[model samples]
Target: MANILEIKNLTKIYKEAQNEICVLKDVSFSVEQGKFIVFIGPSGSGKTTLLNLIAMLDKTTSGSIIFKDKDLTKIDENLAAKTRLLDMGFVFQFDALLPEFTVLENILMPAIIANKKAKTYAKYLLEKFGISHLANKFPPSLSGGEKQRAALARALINKPTILLADEPTGNLDTQRKEQIFKDFAQTAKEEGTTILMVTHDIHAANYADKCYKIEGGKVE
Candidate 1:
């Protein structure tokens, strides 16, 4: 598989009151197409910060993030937003589905934003996640697992080149978390969508094709 994203000597810092705190220090890695990569670390170890940098949700203090031969660290927010919408999908631990919309509508939000018809693919994703029956229900009416499943479907509705998830199964039970990991693995294997997930669940690393650990603001 080819490299979908590359991070070289990436670093992030926070300065307050004349004190400098380093979150991610010279972290480097490459995500290949169709592979599941997980970062396992303790709290405050910069896992989410790293994900934010990769997703363009935050800026890097130094170094470079390259995607498709372009350096994302140098891009303007407009271009970054456009690139994120066009090439990336993000799933947070909480199911961020819209309450006013039905599950189907929530799943189609990406397509609606892009002004493209994705009903067929959205339905396929719902079926694939075994929640086709819940499509017509509102988010508040669904269970946690169901909501997360719908969120997963929504994330994939755009068929992005990569998916960035931050502790995606944190709100679920063990059984549900296992199911989510299986679904994530299957998605990467079948649809060839690159997956980068950050979680403290060491067990979750089992389902990933590549696993890295972060300690003292460095990844290995």
Candidate 2:
């Protein structure tokens, strides 16, 4: 498998009260195509910050991020946004579904925004994730697991090459978390999707192809 994402000497800093808070420092990693990599760490360990940088949702203070052979750190905001829409799928710790839209509609929202033809595939994903029964229901009516599954379906609707998940199973119970991880693993395998997930649960990290532990802004 070829490298799909690369990070070199990544660092992120935040300014607060005349002090510099270093969130990440000298982090370097690479993710291969069709592989699932998990980052596990305790709270406030900068895992989320790393994910944000990788997803291009936040800028790095310094370093290089190469995705699909292009250097993201050097790109303009417009190009970064375009790249994110075209190639990245994100699952937040929370479902982040729209309360006004039905499950199907929520799943189709990304495709609509990207102006991509994906209605048919969205339906297929809904069925694959076993959320077809709730397709017409709203987000508030669903269980946590159900909502997460719906969110996953929406993220995948665009058939993204890379899926970035932030504590994807954080809100679920043990059984549901296991089920969701299984679903994620199966879907990534079938779709040849490269997944980079930030999680705290050791069991959840076990579901990934590889796992790294981040502490004090460095991977251990």
Candidate 3:
């Protein structure tokens, strides 16, 4: 597999008053195509910040992030938005489903934003995740597990090569958490999606092809 993303000497520093809070320092790594990579660490260890930089959701204090041979750190915000919408899929800790929309509608949002029809793919994802029956149901009507499944389906609708997940199973039970990671692993295998996920759950490590432990602003 080719290198999908490469980070060299990444660093993030926040100066609060006279004290400088360094979130990340001289971090470096590479992500390959179709790999399930995980970053595990304690709170405030810069895992999320590193993910955000890789996702192009934030600027690095100092470093170079090369995605597909292009330097993301130098891209303008407009390009960043387009890159986020077309190249990356995100599954946040809260699921972030719209309350007023049904499962299928929520999943179709990215396509709609891109002015494309996604009904066929949306239906396929729902079926793939065993949530086709809930297509018309709103987020509030779904269980924690069901909502997360729907969120996963939504993330895949755009067929993003990269999926960035942050604590995706934070609100689910043990069984549900295990099931979600299993689904994620299967998705990566069959769909050729490169997943980079950050979680505090040590159990999540079992499903990853490679794991990195971040501590004290560094990756090991």
Candidate 4:
């Protein structure tokens, strides 16, 4: 399989007053298409920083982030925003669902933002995730695991080429967490979506095709 994403000599530095903090130091890796990749580390490690850089949520100090052969580090904000909306999907620790919207509506939000008609595909996603029964339900009425499943469905509504997940299972219990991991692995294989996830939970390693350990600003 070809590499869908590449990170080379990536570094990030944050300046606070007179202090300078380096979160990621010359980190590098490549992700193959349709593979589930996970970065596990303790709090304050550069795992989240790495995902932020790839998602273009944060800028890199100096390095290259190549996605589909395009240097994301060089793209302007407008193009980056378009790339994020059209080609990439994100799921963070929180479900981030709107309480007023039905589960189906929430899943279609991204497609709506992109001016695409994807209601049928959204329904399919819900069914695939085993949450089709919750289509008419509001987010507040759903359980923690159900809400996360809805969030996952929302992320896939656009058929994004890559999925960026940051501690996506953080709020779930053990059973739910493991189920989410299984879902991710299956999604990667069946949907052909390259997945890059960052988390402190070591259990995620069991589901990943490639696992990296990040600590003290380095990956190994």
The TM-score values for the models, in the order shown, are: 0.98, 0.97, 0.97, 0.98
Clashes of 2: 0
lDDT of 1 by residue, 1-220 (tens): 7898899999999899999999999988888899999999998999889989988888899999998888999989999888787789889989999999999999999889988899999989999999999989999999898998899999998999899999988989999999999999999999999999999999888899999999898999
- List ranges where model 1 is wrong by over 4 Å: none
What C-alpha lDDT do the candidate models reach, one value each?
Answer: 0.92, 0.90, 0.91, 0.93
Question: In angstroms, what RMSD does candidate 4 have relative to the true structure?
Answer: 0.7
Deviation in Å, model 4, residue 19 alpha carbon: 0.8
Clashes per candidate (backbone, < 3 Å): 0, 0, 0, 0
Output the worst ten-in-a-row residue range by lDDT, candidate 2. Answer: 179-188
What tens digits encode model 2's per-residue C-alpha lDDT throughout 30-140? 888988888889999998899888877788999999999988889888988887887899999999999999999999998999998887898899889888899999999
Predict model 3's lDDT versus the native. 0.91
Q: After superposition, how far is residue 156 of candidate 2 from its true place, in Å?
A: 0.5
Q: Quote the lDDT for 106 in model 1.
A: 97
TM-score, candidate number 1: 0.98
Cα displacement (Å) at residue 141, model 3: 0.8
Candidate 3 stretches with Cα past 4 Å from truth are none
